[model samples]
Target: MSSFCPNCPDQTIVDPPQTVYENYYHPQHVQVIHPVEIIRQHHCVPVYHHCVTYTVKDKMCTVSGLKKKSRKRK
Candidate 1:
């Protein structure tokens, strides 16, 4: 009645079970809404007319220097 152990030194009694790869991340809660469109452009305000005419022997006449009209804010 003996399972061989006469001062035992034979190596390998139990060694076979290894296959491991781990990466775990779970956190999901998402609500996304994107809608933006704004376009408003209206420009119509420009009227300037200045006419001067003189005939029949004109000695000397000169008038040129007028540019100061810009104020629009509302």
Candidate 2:
């Protein structure tokens, strides 16, 4: 569910519940991914990727589930 501001059409996304696992990995070849939070700060979109933070403005703010692009071979 989202909450809309009266002065603007932008919606505020709510954060999900946090869960803790005692042991999420095994002895070998284990991988884990942390959840991310995204929201509109002023006029820009704040994206959190681990310890790094990025921003997207205007219409680009509407895009979701983005990842870094890889270069194509010539």
User: What are the TM-scores, per candidate, against the unseen true structure?
Assistant: 0.22, 0.19
TM-score of 2: 0.19
lDDT of each: 0.83, 0.79
What lDDT score goes with residue 18 in model 1?
A: 86
Best of the candidates, TM-score:
1
Over the stretch 9-59, how does candidate 2's per-residue lDDT look in tens digits? 777898998998797755786688999999867776788777867997775
* Global lDDT of model 2: 0.79
lDDT of 1 by residue, 1-74 (tens): 87986887778677697889898989898988898999898999989898999788757755669666899998
TM-score, model 1 to reference: 0.22
Instruction: Name the regions of candidate 1 deviating beyond 4 angstroms.
Output: 1-33, 58-74
RMSD of each candidate relative to the true structure: 23.5, 48.8
